[model samples]
Target: MDASIGRTAREQLTGRYVLSLVAFLALVYGVTQDIETVFAITLGLAFVETISILRDTPTVDSRWVGVGLGAFITIASLAWFAWELTTAAGTGGPVWFPALTALIGVWFIFDARADFADGTDSYAPDDMDASEMMLVLNHGHLVVEELRQGPKTVPELADACDLTESRVREALDVATDDGMVYPVDGGPIDDVERYALDESKVGGVAFVRSNGKRILRRIARPFRR
Candidate 1:
């Protein structure tokens, strides 16, 4: 499966952002055009985004409540919009808008299910290949370093890495997806989630550089703090 797709995780994430933004904007434009049912649907979508902002899944507590909320909102919005679209007559607005919305809805549903199962903070259409996995795990050196010392909470990793909590979580999720990391408590993460490293998977030139980087970071951490 390593060669399933050549795209990297970062590239996948960028594409997802662009696609979601375009879908959202099209709905807005449809509203301006007074496309029937577009207004209610847009409002529902807006509410979903607002909840996501308030919950802040990327940096939220590891209890998975925020993740569940995000998934819920996603499907709910689609359901509401779908109902509206079906019940009302089309203003014959751009045929493309509804089609795009449906496509995006399908994607959202798939991803929402995934987000609930695994705390993947980033978009992952499918399992990453070996090289893609390496690339993601490599960029998260500080997280690996902290985990090697022992298990760590998101805030602890964030502090150690001098990265925003959100970015630290993203790194953890990326590593987790590749089997390079996992929660210390096993199956379900509790209120205070602490992640541990899988040393078996940590071997390679990437970790060699990462080990050197960790050593350097340890030396400079005090001053940086």
Candidate 2:
């Protein structure tokens, strides 16, 4: 299962790199002949990338910022395209094009910075406890945080954590044994078991509420070195 997951991740990374290369080449080609086409294609690629990022990191602030930026870029690109179409052939565009493009470039830079700020580098620890610590620091906390809102079945937890149901079940089992999570009544489901955080446990609740950013940095510490 681990090998299969690694293979799937590799395939996805390869595909993203290839698509990015294609988009970059297309943008360069469009720049030489049709500036409007460049804007349209760039906007499309930006939207695609934004959607991919949001899927991987479904945080509320990131979602709102990404959507706002995407909407603005889409509207600006469309307006520029329309202007180009209406303008007479061989006539130049407005003087603000360069300034607007520069602002957009800055936006991209900030967007990338934000992604890095919220993202963590992958790490592989040899020790079993180390591995478990990393999981509890990241995915485990995420699961508990989600459950803090309400109880959730395995499938719901998996979806919330962007993990497989089997993986979520395994994590839940461990957490249950540790007395961090408890089985709750499964609503409308006969066989499925729902889980919730045991708020009565002070340590568990504190760990669930711990600073996520700090935990992510700790996870990436070894990798950074």
Candidate 3:
């Protein structure tokens, strides 16, 4: 039971499951004339997939992949409904259904884009070089991203990063020492601190804020004049 080999196997299994789910949904839509059934199945499958992603053990892509798949299904559902509306005319069905679906589709597209962009850094810790390792280990860069929205307890951090409590604490301490996070005004019992958004003069300050968070103060590097 080599760990890396097990992770590779899990990755392969997840990929296969995602592909099969996508294909099955497509087939069902193509073969079935009922829009309701299509929507129902898609919704149910998306829910199940989301839950599976969230509950998946370490080494899986988790929520990011679920978000992407959900987005794809949302867009497809919208297109299907829109076609139905156009072909059958207003009398065929309610126009709002398609309209609502279209909105959901657009939202999902935005969500998927953001999720993919965020996950570009989702490699295992061993694969990371020094800079990335610093982010994961010393700076809480990834943890900040995960908890930037609110305060998270140790368990939450563990679940998010697929690491144990001790590791999460070590990382969190580094972040706190570096001033990335601190106790929120009214947060969890463990002096839970919210990860502040880095408002540094660094170019990514704006990007971080765009995703929504309190602007973080800059940690001036020595090289900067």
List where candidate 1 sits over 4 angstroms from the true fold: 1-139, 186-191, 205-225
Q: Report model 2's TM-score to 2 decimal places.
A: 0.32
9 Cα displacement, candidate 2 (Å): 33
Estimate, for each residue in 6-123, the C-alpha lDDT of model 3 and write its tens digit: 5544664587787897888788878997778888898887665444434344555544554555576677667767677667543467667766776665554454455466564222
For candidate 1, the 10 contiguous residues with the lowest summed lDDT are 1-10
Quickly count the clashes in candidate 3. Answer: 3
Q: Per-residue lDDT of 100-206 in model 2, one digit per residue for the tens?
A: 65456445434444455657322111235666767755777678788988889888999989988877876776677647799977667575788888777537456
TM per model? 0.30, 0.32, 0.30
Report the C-alpha lDDT of model 1 over 23-78, residue by residue, as the tens digit.
Answer: 97686776687554566766666565544443333344323443455465556555
Worst lDDT window (10 residues) for model 3? Answer: 215-224
* Predicted structure 2: lDDT: 0.62
Off by over 4 Å in 2: 1-129, 187-189, 202-225
Cα RMSD (angstroms) for every candidate in the order listed: 18.5, 15.0, 14.3
Question: What is each predicted model's overall lDDT from 0 to 1?
Answer: 0.62, 0.62, 0.58
Query: Candidate 2: minimum summed lDDT over ten consecutive residues — where?
Result: 120-129
